[model samples]
Target: MKGKEKIKVGITIGDLNGIGGEIILKTFEDNRMLDFCTPVIFASVKTISYLKKHFKFNLNFNGINTIDKIVHGKINVFNAWNEKYNIEFGKENLKSGELSIKSLKEAVKYLKSGDIDALVTAPINKHNIQSEEFKFPGHTDYLAQELEGNSLMFMVTDTLKVGLLTDHVPVNDVTKHISEKLIKNKLDIINLSLKQDFKVRKPKIAVLGINPHTGDNGVIGKEDDEILRPALSKIREKGMLVFGPYAADSFFGSNNYKNFDAIIASYHDQGLIPFKTLSFGNGVNFTAGLSKVRTSPDHGTAYEIAGKGEADENSFKQAVFTAIKIFKNRKEYKNLTKNPLKPKQKKI
Candidate 1:
């Protein structure tokens, strides 16, 4: 990390049976991307080479077994595993899940050790990737346990940003999950993330309601009136620019989301449905409020479009860019805050 050194971004090859390989290769195909950040993919050279040949990509990679051997100007493939994989497109298998977790764990190892500046994970099948070692719902929950701070699933683009209060929970259980403490904690995370990760000076955040039309004063549901409103009021007293519990149905359609720095949705679908609809191929799923930086494409593993070369790499590329930007922003923030400016003495 000297002058003009590129940020080393560690990427995990998620669910090799899916489109992870396709998107990863597609993103690095344009050699100009190397100038931005050095990519270290956590998969074997054999796996990447198989993908290259399967997709007929004219991409070259520098394969290495250790992080010290990473070449800054080329795509570095760190051999997380040595075994050959059977690439069955659009199929779910335990082997793919095992490999995906292996890649992820190896990447996290480097990320924690400061071997990599940031991480950009490829999409993984949530169901198949489950085991005794990994029992979380998805990346956010898993990272929250492994990382230092509370994690928030922040789906972001340049203009639009949405964070979920409760992600990967069933709709039936979503209401039970929302409470005053949860709301305040999530708001705090979102506020801090905006200032440090996204560089917003004064963040104005809006929260969507649990029920339609925000319960219409208790007609639709009581959770919005009984729980969300009070929590938001308490947060506002802390001098944060927080508002809402607005009607979720028409918020984005009415373009009211444009007024705030970020929006906090009550549940997963409430946030991601509108978010994916708006920024599917361009949005980056940033895991905020963690000591380490990690981001991914907004969409999941597109099993249906696995090996057809139809998967758009825009979101994946954006994920890489977002990780690099956040890493630099966090570093700058740390440097600025490490030493506070002393107050000037009054003239005698």
Candidate 2:
């Protein structure tokens, strides 16, 4: 899946005031980086210029009014907005948030039209990028609404893959979100993603407990022993390579995540805290179970280092690479399964 074809990855300028433009420019500065995929950034020409000048980045871009003019081996900037806006670095304003959504909406338009193979979104301030037009918790929900099927926020690195069962919810509200049906459905999505998107045959999944020490046999909390255990049993009965209601506290500390292909966390922080600590500035957040491929840097908008030229672009680069890899993997998987070896009338 490495060099099958050059994929067109459409990028969104998350927040004009944040490090979105900086990382995008940094990642595409290396001419050798265009070997596997062509990048089309959905942003205004003025905005790109502002970032390039402010950061003192040595780079060039191809400007186009539409996706039809996208060219390979060069950074293509598709004009998502024409109006000039202020580049207030390290400050959040309504205009910056509005433009971020504009960029995102334009990128999604091309993505749905099949002009781009996958999408690589830059970091956005969840609070600022909120309005009547965009009223979701984050990119995961927004993309899910645009594309078909469910969406899972899967954080990936070299050694660990973590999926959250409950995303962007309060700690007190986490327990209400957990149920046998929900767990089973998420497990189904994870299993299929491993096979099709990741090419992991016979994938092993590790399920985490909601409570500390896995409830200590109903001492610490009954949700782990009662809710999580039953869900795991039912999931295994369905012929999945799954195990454990492992105690979340000691799971990463003891390095138990290395044994499985993916880990399912009951909530957000349980999985991400460890993943961020381990991968830091290089992890990619992939949205699984959607028809369109979407990925982003695991970290969010770092306002402190917005225009200081100190923001790291490794994670953004990984997001682009990961999107291309998944696109190729899905294509290869589709061709392999287009026809079965056995006759259609034959029963196994």
**Clashes in model 1: which pairs?**
none
**Candidate 2 C-alpha lDDT tens digits along 122-169:** 999888888988898878999999988788889997678999899899
Estimate the TM-score of every prediction.
0.96, 0.95
Model 1, span 268-304: residue lDDT tens: 9999989999985899999999999999998888999
- Model 1 spans > 4 angstroms off: 1-4, 341-348
Q: What does the lDDT read for residue 23 in candidate 1?
A: 88
lDDT winner among the candidates?
1
Can you tell me which runs of candidate 2 are displaced by over 4 Å? 1-5, 341-348
